[model samples]
Target: MVFARYLTPAAECGGLGLQCLGVGWQQVSRIQFDGRVIDCYGLMMIVRGTGWFVWGDLPRQRVPVQAPALFVVFPGVYHAYQPDAGGWSERWVLFNGPSAHTHEVLGTLDRDAPVMVLQGPLDGMERVFESLFEAADSSSPHRDVVTSSLVHRLLAELLAVKATTDVARVVRHFDEQATGPLSIGEHARRLGMDTPTLRREMFRATGTTPKDYILRTRLSMAQRLLLTTDRTVAEIARCVGYSDAAYFTRLFSRRVGQAPSHFRKVGRPRGRDG
Candidate 1:
């Protein structure tokens, strides 16, 4: 299956200094981009299968990659990549702006070494890509602004996963399981550590307690559902791990400073149904 969306930024989107030119995902027997130096940045995530990549001029290096790997396509760089005979599935985003250069300067994206083996539970990263694809839809309101924010978020999440530390694993675990029943004690035990050690590690890495992080993660999902889906508040509440609708409302109101219904009304695209 192959699907892609290309976006043209509105005038107002330029001030943000970031624009997502396109978003796409494909399942293919083979694919290649070679011979021409492109003028925009591309982020590609290999969802399945193995591949070989060759980049640079004259003295290029050929790299073998497995599934769940990520690679960057720098503007004007000589690069080419293709899956093995078995093929692979990939999700990619095309973007360009001053912000991309800033990330390069900050060491968030290294042009010299463009690919990294992604580690830990990838569910969270996949969700971000899915959200980016959805937000780039032409029918979605504020396409440019939303896609730009999602791109930034994608980078941050990528960095966290690449850290490859115990805390990073813990965070990925929470990210994947936040909508289900969870307990700090159970998680710590699973990690072969005491609750205090887990707590300390989480605090040092994220500056937030595990409990609070879970709460924030759940609420973030709740907000996304509220804006993008037609599900009722009760359903969304349950979907995000709150069984009691009234209690969920109370917590959401306290933390988010607005009722879910009100937030949806203000945030949902015009003319969109329930």
Candidate 2:
């Protein structure tokens, strides 16, 4: 059996607003859990297994058989199980803390319904498992935040594989134009679609107007440059697609709640200030 653990601290719990207690992984056989009911609110992904789950007083329910089956168990739920006579192998993780939101995000599925099962075996299962494990074992600042972020990423990958799509083209386009100072009309012409049609399709596909998305992206780039580079505000403005420094300052101040110079001086370390 292989075992790993990751521990998170309190200070770094921000953004998604959850404090991760810890994450752990274990690969074990039936003998390890013979006649034991593990209790916790976390997740379990069966890399290899043929087993059933037994709740108190309930007849055993065969785990919906699948290679790479992922299960989510809520806190306090009664659970006990063993692999079929042939025996089984599986991987699992246990996490807890006020910031844990695994159960909440996956609430649509019955706790025992088996959240997802990859159609085929997946590579990198160990990396995912170990990442969470290391996060649980460490006490570095913001470990919990980082662990929670990784958890979301893992779930996203699973979902993406399960529902493959051609939206890659749209995503690529968004990435390319996000920080560019291209107008919606120019973007529509470049994509060979009329403005209204392009707007409709972009909104339908990405849920945001191209102009708004581009503005936000440019703002983000401007912020990064402000924090990490020594470029003048005017130069950074042009780099992020704002030809007019004053206009850029207005936009930045409106969105970030501070003047560009003040933001740089107060928000970033002096050495990092550009």
Candidate 3:
């Protein structure tokens, strides 16, 4: 069994969106766990053997598990797992951040389907786990940042494999209509899908709800326009489907951590002729 350890990152790490609290890989035998709750999120990848799991408020229904699978542990949610006849080999990481919470709300980090089956060769993911372990063990001042990035990388890898064709269509539609004053409900109707199904499919494919996805697309277009054109903030807001510049500014500042005007001024390179 590999050694496991937890960490307390520097306070500044929290500002980076996600913080790695602990990480390790282990092999277990004859382990029977009842249930437990934690304050942070956890992702456990089962590499070998089989297990069973259940989570909810109470009177939970158990889920059967197998190798090459992953399960999520939600904060404040009661969950339990145990190895089948044979034990399981697993890699696990604990993390929490505003970004993580946003994903949960957006339906990307699903609570209903906490455990997921991973496909394809896992060598790539194992390599990342190795890097995570090394970074977590490092004493460098930037260790937290490095480890956090690796965690993001792992999630990206998972998404890359999990996204389906239906999700691709949804993303394409969102991108095409990002600048229009269209509601997600309308978009769902256009696709002949109900709002909830669209949401579920979108979460399965992109780890975001339709509403969040369109907002991101709009803001992305707004950023491009801000950098490439001389449009006023109000004009840019309207271009992105926001009639209220003041409200847009509030959202931009909250998400991007700067006012639109400040972002344009600072993000652009100064011409040498000036």
Candidate 4:
């Protein structure tokens, strides 16, 4: 058990809005935990070996899993986890902070379903935790605030990566069609998915609808043309698959905040000040 503690000084007055109670790494060669409900929110990431997370009421299932995964212990949740006899290595953070509740609100952490299996290698996340620990250990003023900020940043990145596996194929297909002319339904068919399913999945992965994504791609092409070529707006519009120059210019002006001709002159989209 390699652990470091951060004890708040009484003279420091009220606590930092958020605080890291402890940070550590442990090689679990022989450890058995019956389970305990704790007050602080915890996030543990497995660096090696396999394990089982046993939790919940009624059904009480034991989820057999391996490394490169993270599990959270929401405050007041009864959770027990242990490594297989082969053993495991773990990195963890025990924190009590308002940001922890923000994690729950963002659906990044759930009290009922507390496990998230990482899709790939965790070297990047390992470094993040190390930096977080270092920040907490430093004696700099407002280091507590810094640690809390790092915690929220880590949670945001984790949520961004969650469920990214399913979108790999969609992303591949999207890249292939980066300059093509295809309707949302046609693009959906290219990926062997119905329009609605693709729409939902794309939105989940990218936070934009299929139609909006294609439009953005098209607009990017138009921006490139305006920057690099002497082509007329009508010619550039046709190259990006727009039939009418007027409609394309209107749409471009709406999204880019400048008339196409003006953008071509200014080398950038104009703002309200412009």
lDDT ranking, best first: 1, 3, 4, 2
Please write out the lDDT profile of model 1 over residues 1-274, one tens digit for every residue: 8889998888778678778899999997976656557899988899899997777778986778888888888998988898998999999999888888888865557676677667667877899999987787658677788998888888778767755545666787788877878688987766545788678778877899989888888888988999999999999999999999999998887788778999898874221112
Q: What are the lDDT figures for the candidates, one per model?
A: 0.81, 0.60, 0.81, 0.74
* Candidates sorted by TM-score, best first: 3, 1, 4, 2
lDDT of 4 by residue, 1-274 (tens): 6756554523342244456666778788848799988888888888789988877675775676587777888777678888888998888887776666777776677665576667744555767788887886788887766776666666767776554633765766775685577778888766646787688778877798877777777788888899999999999999887989999999899888998899988888654312
Candidate 1, residue 250: Cα displacement in angstroms equals 68
lDDT score, candidate 1, position 126: 94
**TM-score against truth, every candidate:** 0.58, 0.45, 0.60, 0.57
lDDT of 3 by residue, 1-274 (tens): 6868788988988898889999999998857687899999998889999988899886785788898888889999999999887899999999988888776764446787777666655776788888999998888889899988888887766655445434666777788887787777898877546789789888877787888887777777877888999999999999999999999999887777678898798874232111
User: Number of the top candidate by TM-score?
Assistant: 3
Looking at candidate 1, the ten consecutive residues that score lowest on lDDT are 265-274
Task: Return the TM-score for candidate 3, rounded to 2 decimals.
Answer: 0.60
TM-score result, candidate 4: 0.57
